[model samples]
Target chain A: MIEFDNVSLRLSAFALHEVSLTIMAGDYYFIMGPSGAGKTILLEALAGLHIPDEGRILLKGEDITGIPPEMRKIGLVYQDYSLFPHMTVEKNIGFGLRMQGLHHPERKKRVDTLMKKLGVGHLAQRAPLTLSGGEMQRVAIARALAIEPEILLLDEPLSALDPIMRDFFVDELRELHREQGLTIVQVTHERHEALNLGTRMALIRDGRLEQEGAIDDVFVRPRTRTAAEFMGFENIIPGIVSDAGGPDCRFDTGTVSFSCSTKAIKGENGAVCIRADDISVREKTDPGTDRDNTYRGKIVAVNPSGPMVRIDVDIGLNIVMVMSRKTFESRHLKKGSEIVLTVSPDDIYIISTGTPDTTCS
Target chain B: MTSRIKPDLCLISFALVGSTLVILILLALLNITATQLSDIPFLLQVAQDSRVTDSILLTFTAGLNAVIILVLLGTPLAYVLARTHSRFNNIIESIIDIPLVLPHTVAGIMIYLLFMQRGLIGAPLKDVGFIFEDAYPGIVAAMLFVALPFYVDTAREGFEKVPLHLENVARTLGATRFRAFSLVVFPLSIRHILNGCILAWGRAISEFAAVIMIAYYPMVISTLIYYRFTTGGIKESTAIAFLMILASFSVFVLLRLVTRYVGRYDDRV
Candidate 1:
């Protein structure tokens, strides 16, 4: 287990503000944030690259805040792979073993094992500069795992690859995690990657970790408006609770209303966080009467991406809904078509706006 | 008519600049070859002379030693200058360039003042049984003082080209700071550092004014050529000069070929 206890660092132009996190043994954790949100800094901190100004870091319950990177027993893989340009693939993979004073024969055996495991044994003699992007990535992973680190920190590892390669590597990484039960901490801005690989995740914004929980929990129930927004909740309708003296309250936006189940009092102005995937779309008259909240809206945009299609609907206010491609094709979604979106009251997450959106003013 | 005149002017400008460079280099080559032709037996006599041969070998030895010392001491300073972004680093970097712009004779005078007996550095060194006056140490010190800026500036450029994240990643991969530098940073910047060493060594070999002040007794090749010119006629001096040119050219070509072979991993790496 790795624990960061209120780690704060004041770097130039950016500061990590009181980031506390814990990664359990065998956990596949991801730190998700936008560009320049200090996600890389957090990963570097775990790798012992940046010492925190205030706080203690514990590795397996032992305080290791002052340990140098070489003694940290944590491996790091960067987005560019950062392979030793001077060394061939075999030498690059064997570098850590040499540093550890391993004998030549043993080092060679271990290097060969990792190379074969990562499927780069054939390119052992090839220089790192001659390898393709995917090949270099494999060698980098092989080099990192050669050390047999307690935890591996990956900073945007798949961000450089094409979509097909990204999926292939992501699957490979998932398989590795399951087979080895290695504690891995990967930082990424790509939401799909986080959703796919993350067993637990932390959402970071403006250098502050806004939320941390199980991956499904953070996606389904983001605690703050900012967390909800960062999690790609498209229907962040700012509204106030009315008729709130019950299990379900009517949250009314200036332009539309949503029935949400929350303890927020009457006249409490807040936002309803709704994931696009939770809001299901159907033909105008095809919906059964079971949905607690249903609204008829006109489709304003149809965006089909891979397996899912995101359709924006204007129901007094615009709300985006995501469905599988098959559903989209069967319903024949198009702009200007009328559709009914059914969103259950339980799916509508209500939270304070955290900070007002003052940029427009 | 204006467009036609513009093309004509552009063509004339290109031809003028290109021919000037080509002609100047050819003129020097023609002059050296003509001098050699004037004294074919004299060239062989100069090459065989014990004093001339000793001076030529000594010059190369001292210049090679000076370049080695500069790499040992100046490389870290160059790296610091490349990575630092402070006013103090700017001041230090500017100080490093002083040798590049100072007059060679004036630089020699300054070095002489600092290394002479009873001088600040010389007194301490003399006590340690290492005197510089009239010795090979003095020769190398003078050469190093004059040639270091070339090595440092080129090395700084090389260090700047390497991304800092590469070193950071190496550190996380179980290597300490020095190990990472030796395994990653040094190899990536080897080509530039080698180029710098060659430039510095070449400058040290050709240096005469600075070396003449501190250590004229040991008689480096450049100082010997000067002495021959003052005592003997132009024919004698020209023969030695041609020999020195041939020696320096051969060494330079050999070094360049080695550099190209070893530093083959350029942009691809």
Candidate 2:
């Protein structure tokens, strides 16, 4: 278990603002944000490589904020592996044991067991430089695990590889976690990567964790506008709740009206949040099946995106609908075509109107 | 990654000039012995004297001492320099390289003056019973002064090449600053350190002016050769010169083999 209790750290151009998180035993947590968002800083802090400016860190419920990284019993893996070039694969795996004053024969035995587990037994005698990317990663993991650390921290471990290798390495990393049941804290900016690898994900923005939840919950339901936008929603427009319909609210988007699902929707002017994929396109004559939140508009633009088409409609107010290539081609939609934009009342959630005031949360 | 190459005449001329200079140095060194070539065997036998053996041994000892001291003292300095972000780092690095380009005789005089008992470094050093004049210490000091650049430069290069990421990774892996340097930085630099030692030893063995000014009693091979040439005629001098060549050549080959064995992992080929 690793916990950051109100930890604040300052680095060259980034600072973590009073970050407090608890990572339970056997949890695979990924903290994600854009570049310079302090993801690396937080990981380094957990490892005890950089002391936080404020607050204490705890491991297994014991305060370890002042402990050195090695003594903290936390293992760290870098993107490039940082394998000891002078040592053979087995030696690299056994380095921590050697450091701990373990006997050579005993170290070798443990290393061999780990090599078999990682399917790298044949590579024991080879130098690390001779190994492939996947092979090296396994070696690094084995090296870290030799000491049986309480927690394992990976800093963008797959960021150095090509796209294809990334999937393979991620799978291998997942397997490693499953086999060891080690507390793993991975930091990455790639949303898809975090979504795939993390049992629970923390979305960080501007040095603060904006939201954190299980992958499914965080993906389908984000708590804030920033969280939704970070999850790949590109179209966000401003609007105001004109009427409180008790169960559902009517938002006046100036040019276009939208019905949102805000339970406490009273006296609020905010942005109406609709994921581009939530908007559907159909011909006007036969209105699409009973979805209450629908608008008629002319297709203002149909732009080609990789494997998806992003179509913009001007229902007097411009709104976007993103669809897969098949749906896009099937609808025979063009920029000049006239279509109805339909969204479920559930799909259009209300995002707090202006910049969220300091006390909004 | 690259564009087509364009050859220039100036570079070709530069390389030609370099090769010719090496050839000229070799020819000049060998020229004095041509006339007395027939009497070489007798001269060669005379060259294997106590004087020749002692001089060679002394030179080797001093060079070894200087190199070992440099490694012990210079490593931490190099690492500190590597970590610094200060603008002063450039000035210090450039200053370290001054010995590399400075004239040998001029360096010898500088080292002499610095260690003259009444002079800056010498007065303090003398308090520790390290009398530099006409002693083995003087010879070693001269060698160290001339060869300082090789170790410092190579060591700095080694420190720089052990990428910052590797150190960070070590730190994250639970290693402390000192532990990280010992395991990661030190191992990575061993090969470079060996190379520096070889270069330093080469410079030390070939040094003449500095040793002459500081220590004349414990005569190194170069000084012995000069002393022999002035006292005895060219025949006697050629014998000592040729013997020194053979002895230095064999020692160099041995050092090369050892360095290769130790650094086989670092060898790309």
lDDT of prediction 1: 0.87
Candidate 1 lDDT over residue span A280-348, tens digit each:
764556655553688888999988899988888999998888888897778766789887778888888
Name model 1 segments beyond 4 Å from true. A280-291, A294-310, A322-342, A354-361, B1-19, B82-87, B266-269
Candidate 1 fraction of reference contacts recovered: 0.70
By TM-score, how accurate is candidate 1?
0.90
DockQ for candidate 1, please give it: 0.58
- Per-model i-RMS: 2.0, 2.6
Best by TM-score: 1
RMSD of each: 4.5, 4.5
Candidate 2 residue pairs in clash (backbone atoms < 3 Å): A69-B174, A70-B174, A270-A353
- Candidates' chain A TM-scores: 0.90, 0.90
> Best candidate, lDDT-wise?
1
Backbone clash tally (model 1): 0
Candidate 1 clashing pairs, residues 3+ apart or interchain:
none
